[model samples]
Target: MTTETVAQALLDAQVAWAINRLTGDELPELAAKAVDDVLAIAESTTMSSLADPELIKSIARTIAATVPPSTAASTLVEHSAEVVLSNPAGTYTLREVVDRDHVERITDEALGLTPLVEKVLDDLTHSPMTAAIASRFVGRIVNDVVAGNRAMAEKIPGVGSLVSFGTKAAGKAIGKTGEQFEAFFGDTAAKGAEFAMGRLNKIIIATLKDPATRDAVLEVFDLYADKPIGRLDKVLSLDDAKRIGGLGQDVVITAAASEPVLKLVDALIDGFFTVYGESPAAELLDELDITRDILVEYAVAGAPRVFAAAQESGELDRVVREQLSPFFSSSEVAAILEGR
Candidate 1:
């Protein structure tokens, strides 16, 4: 009731906690129950010792450090950033877990520690294990702690959550059956994708608030628009990759991004010449609008035909004149044998 009594009660409470921990029962019940009890004690006294903001944080740090982390639930709850934000112990313990997990462990325990959580989520969402699980059980979990935080991400402000989701997805996806993968897409099979388009959409729409992102998002949608409608079809169709080969493009591009796209682009470029003959090359050249500055980049990118076109169009000389002419003496065009 009184300040001294409340302070003494808080001290006693903390002592009891430390004693319980030290005696080695590792009282799961006591530890778990303490989470609620401590909050209650703080609320009851209006400003008990445990209620001291500074003290509360300090105790939290201690408890988290002292707690066991081998279990999945512990990793999910106590070692995560969401918990760390609740008190000092959580913050310190989570930071420590993150540091340790980084050097070697893969840090699965500290799944959601930093603003970087988004990036981790994105990576893990594609992780075969997480994806396998999410592909199977995502309807139950993907939407809130999974999907909802996508909206809350900017508020958290970083790439961590997205990366985490992706890592989880990929890891889970590996072991999963086709049924599992289909489930993750929630009937639409959105690339069987989790955070990429979602987070990207969240960001672009929030920033542009118009059809500005419409094209970008549509491009992503187009990727899977025809490939396979469900995970069952996608998995079953992988065999078609060897036969049809085009499916290989989808597999390579969607399974891994950017790098795979680079490979696909290279393959497509090679295939254009290999399969379609020089006709495709002519078609591509015609499709290119040499009139635009954009064409210059493709020209400079070292595509053989693009360079050839640049030379024929006289743009190579123009490009050199525009970009390199300054380096020359500029008095006159040097004749190859004139100097000799």
Candidate 2:
């Protein structure tokens, strides 16, 4: 929280970033070479130059103890909220930050010829969970429709009404009996529920695996995939754009200082290092596709949408004129502008 500590943290982060770049080559051969080089150097390192584990632990503990979760969380949320809320040109500033020219380049690099949509489709289709869920949904709809018709018929005439009444009575009696049985059988209810769910899942999985169901799902995907981006032009048009932007901006401006936000902030800060430390960080990074190239590419590809959306909402002009223009304008220029 002191200037010195802040400076040191920045330097440490820079060193870590440097090390990551040095080791994380896209090519396997280059990565292997980098690992070998690190190993060779590490082999030659003296004990005196090596970091003390106990001392490192002690320092980590000291830093953690100093930064109380409640205070740290509150300070971070308050400061960030203040920066956005207190600024006269905050919305404009946000637009300017988003609209920079580097965004397209970033996007191009990140989105590099990956056949992203196709990959997504392939992944979804191959996922067991997706197949299982889809089958279950279809089964549930069929069952509901059939059951509804029967139930509706039971409520129609005199005999039907009597049958409906009897059905309800029977259901209540069965439920009561089941509860009593469960009470005597300890975890019988839980086991029964689990068994029922497992059987339902199996049926759903079978339905999903059916040729007709699978073909129908794929056909839907194919139809959608064939549609042009222009099909979405209306959704991203000015009226819709402003509504979306305004809603998001309103939520941020209004929600930042709330208790729920502070709780989230606290949880994130408190768990940050601990969560990642439990796993091999390198493996986690690889699994998550957190390579520098991928990250840089995603940022470039995605950054421009922020600006484009802001411009669509007429926020970009406000940012440039209100927030940026005055800095270079002298009193005479300001007066002339005022006169205009």
lDDT per residue (tens digit) for residues 116-198 in model 2: 53345445544555645654665587669857876888777766777667768877998899788867975564445444445
Assess candidate 2 and give its lDDT: 0.52
Query: Model 1: residues >4 Å from true position, as ranges?
Result: 1-50, 71-214, 218-340
Tens digits of per-residue lDDT for model 1, 1-340: 5444444454455544544353334544444454445434433432222133344445544443343332443344433433323344421223333343243233233322333555555666555455545544544555557556655563575676776678578757754855676666553454444444445435533544444444454455445444433333325343343334444334433444345544554565455445434232324334553332344443334344444566678665555445443323233323322343
Cα displacement (angstroms), candidate 2, residue 266, comes to 33
Query: Per-model C-alpha lDDT, please?
Result: 0.44, 0.52
Best by TM-score: 2
Cα error, residue 6 of model 2, in Å, equals 47
State candidate 2's TM-score.
Answer: 0.27
Evaluate residue 45 in candidate 2 and report its C-alpha lDDT on the 0 to 100 scale: 57
